[model samples]
Target: MFAKTQAAAPVEAPKATGPAIVPGVIDFNVPGCKPEYPRASLRNEETGTVVLSVLIGADGSVADVKIDKSSGFRGLDNAVRTQLMSGACKNKPGTVDGKPQQTWTKVQYVWKLD
Candidate 1:
């Protein structure tokens, strides 16, 4: 008597999570996220990095923003926050397992004089 052989099942490929939008990606060219330098800060020559915890909606809109770390200057911090919350920044939503999801991500904005 001969034994029968079974066929192997097909395996599916892992899904791609696409491009990540980490803190390093947050910059002046982030679509509508270009924050104008505060006039007071500009005149005072204040420069620092403002760290923020931003909640992005699945529809690619900034839902909320909280300052994780201030830039030492209230004007700079407020400027960055205002820009994000003003519905002007159209961010690409963060993805999980290749699917768009509402997520909170850290964003850093650096204030520097040219």
Candidate 2:
């Protein structure tokens, strides 16, 4: 039998280039994430903004959401958490090397009486 030929050289795999980049504060629009008015808060005439620390997954999904600052009303704070976890807050995640990545962002829910 003939001698075995040498193996082929190893080929490097292509790197993952993250999402496109835009200069100067690109508009990262939140698809459809609006906090609804909390029934309890509305009934009590509560008005304030709840700041939330949200973690978005690479696939534009909500990974985690927590209250960074309360709206001075426990009901409002709870409502914010509820709203976020209720699948209302979602946006395109940041990217690195053309690959999607998890990103942290802040979202404020303003509760005002009509």
Best by TM-score: 1
Tens-digit per-residue lDDT, 67-103, candidate 2: 9888899988886677666765556676655667777
| lDDT, candidate 1, at 71 | 90
Q: Please count the clashing residue pairs in each candidate, in the order shown.
A: 0, 6
**What is the alpha-carbon lDDT for the whole of candidate 1?**
0.82
User: Model 1 over residues 1-114: C-alpha lDDT tens digits?
Assistant: 999999989899899877664321245587678889988888889999999998888777888889999999999999989998888778777776556777888878888998
Give me the runs in candidate 1 sitting further than 4 Å from their true place.
1-27
The residue pairs in collision within model 2 are: 16-97, 17-97, 17-98, 18-97, 18-98, 18-99
User: Using alpha carbons, what is the TM-score of model 1?
Assistant: 0.74
Instruction: Please give the distance, in angstroms, between residue 32's alpha carbon in candidate 1 and its true position after superposition.
Output: 2.2
Cα displacement (angstroms), candidate 1, residue 66, comes to 0.8
Task: Give all TM-scores, in the order shown.
Answer: 0.74, 0.65
lDDT (C-alpha, whole model) for all candidates: 0.82, 0.69
